[model samples]
Target: MSGEFDRVARLRAIFAGAHRGVILGIGDDAAILAGDVLATGAVLSTDAAIEDVHFRRAWIGQGVTWRDVAYRAAAAALSDLAAMGAEPRAMLTSWAFPRDVGDDVVDEIARGFRDAADVYGAPVIGGNLARAREIGLTTTVIGAAPARAPRRDGAQAGDVLWATGALGEAALGLAALEAGIAREPDAAAFVSRFVRPPSRIDAGRAAAQSAHAMIDVSDGLLQDLGHLCDASGVGARLDALAPTREADALARRLGVDARALLESGGDDYELLITAAPGVDLSRIAHPIGEITREPGIVGATTARTGFDHFG
Candidate 1:
C-alpha cells in the first residue's frame, strides 16, 4: 500500500470508537450521526489553520508541537459553537501536508484531535487527507444547539456589555514569541493563551440564558464588538477597561500600550455578551461596558483592528 493509505489506516485506528451520537464513524464513505441530537436544533461551524498564516512550523521544537497545532485548530472551530451556546456532538478534520510527512507526525496530530474532542465530548467521525505545499487543518464541528442561542443582532441600547476571561494575554503571547522572549519566566501565561485558547462552552450556555446578544472574542475585542454593534444597530461605551498586572508589565517590556493590547488583541476566545439590567452573569463574566443609543463605538482607542484575511 502507498504511504498515504498507510497513514489513513493508522488514523482510522486512532480515532476508532462507538459514539452513541454517531451511527457510523471513520472508515466509512461518510459519517452518519444520530438524528435526535439534531432534532431540536444543530449548529455547524468550520475553521482553518494554515502554516505561516495561523501558526509557524519553526516554533514546533521550541514551544509549538504537532499536538498543539491540532488542538488549536479544533478549539478555533469549536469556539463558534460556544458562541451560540451549543453542546458539541461531533467533528470532522481535513488535513493537507507535504508528501514527505511521516506516520508518526500524523499520529501525533490525531492524538491532538482526540484530546480536544474528549474535552468537549465531541467525537471525530470523519475526515479527508490530501497533499499540499503547506501543512493545514480545516475542522468542522457539529453541535446540539441551545433553545435560545444568542445572536449578535439582539442587543438593546441599554443592555450591559460583559466579557469572560482576560483580554490581551494572547496578543502579548504572540508578541513574546515573535520577539524570541517567549521563554522568559513571566511570558508563560501569555504564551499559553496564544498556544491554547479556550472554548467557553459552559460560559456560552450560561450567557445564552440571559444575554440579548453574544459573540466569541476571536478577533480583537473592539473589532468583534464592532461587528455585534453593527448587527444590533446600536453603539457601545467602555466604562471600566483595565489589563491584568501581568499583561501590563509585559506590554511595558514589549514597548506597547497595554490598553491597546486589551482593545485590539485577538485569540482570547472569551465570550462578549449583552444583557438587560439586573440580569446576573457574575459567575461567568464581568461587566465591561454598556450599549448606547449612539451609532458608533466609543470609550477606547483602537489604533488597529483585529485579524482579517484580506484586510
Candidate 2:
C-alpha cells in the first residue's frame, strides 16, 4: 500500500481499542469523550489556536509577551464548556512549537494556562508536545452539567436570543493590534479583549437553567447564531435596537462598518442563548434579540447586519 493509505490504516488500528468513554474518536474535527464515572451526562469540547492564523508572535513586540497566548487558549477552551451550560473540570492541551522558541517562552505559556485554569477551578491533567515550524495549540475541555445539558438543538419558536457582553470588541482589538495603535488609551480595552477574552462562565451557567438552547459567540454573533438556528431548525429576528450601543460606538470611533462588525466579527466568546417567550429573562445579562419560526432565516431589524464567513 502507498504511504498515505498505510498511515490511515495504522491510525485506525491504533484507535481500535479505545474505550467506551470515547464518544467520537479519530477522523473527526474533534474527539468527544465521556468519563469513567457515572453521572447525568458529560460534555466534551475542543478549540484550536494557530500561529499567523489566530495570532502572530511579532505582534507582541516590545513590552508584550507570549504568556498572553497561553491564557487566551485556555480561556477559549473553557468557553466551550460554558456554552453547554456545564462547568469545566479538566483540560488536555496539545502543543506544537518551533525549535527556535526559547524555554522561557514555553514557561510563560504554561503560566498563562495555570492562571486561566485557576479562574474556573479546572486543571490541566495531561497533554502532549511536539516539534513544528510554527506554534499551534489545541485544548480539549471536559465538563459536567448536572442532569440537563443545554444543546444547540433545543431552541424553540418565539424564543428570545441574547448575547452576553459587548460585541465586536475582540475584532476591534485585532484591528488595533494590526494598526499598531496599542499606545492609545482606548486600545488598551481592545488589547485586553484580544489578549484575554472573558469566557462567560458564570453567565452561561445562569443562562443554562433558563435558556432553551445556547452557544458561545466564538465565530461572531451572526455566524454562531446561524449554527444554533440550523441545529434547532428555527429562524431568528434580531432587534436592531439591541446591538446599537456597541455597533454605533465602534462605527463612529474606528470607522468600522457597525452592521458588518457585529454580524461577522469573531472571537467575542460571549454566550448566545435562546429562551422561551415571556420567560421573564430580564434578570439575565445582555439579552440581545428573539428567536422565531422562520427556518434558515435570521432577520435583522436593519439591513446589512449579520456575519458571513466567506464574505
TM-score to native of every candidate shown: 0.96, 0.81
1-311: candidate 2 lDDT, tens digit per residue: 12334533443443244343556554545555555432656678888888987878877762246878888888988998888888776667887888777656766776777777678666665566677899998998877774566789999988878778777777777776777775577566777887888868887788888889988887877778888998999888777633456445645677776566667678788888888766665565556677777775554533333444357
Instruction: Return the lDDT, model 2, position 259.
Output: 62
Every candidate's CA RMSD: 1.5, 7.9
Which pairs clash in the backbone of model 1?
none
In order, candidate lDDTs are 0.87, 0.72
Looking at model 2, report the run of 10 residues with the lowest lDDT sum. Answer: 1-10
Clash totals for all models, in order?
0, 2
Q: Best by lDDT, which number? A: 1
lDDT of 1 by residue, 1-311 (tens): 14767777888888887777799998869999989988869899999999899888777765667888788889889999999988999999999988777777788889989988888889999999998998899999999988899999999999999999998788888888877787788887788788888879999988888889999988899999999999999999987588888789888998888788899988888899999988989898999999998978888876548889998
lDDT of 1 at 231: 97
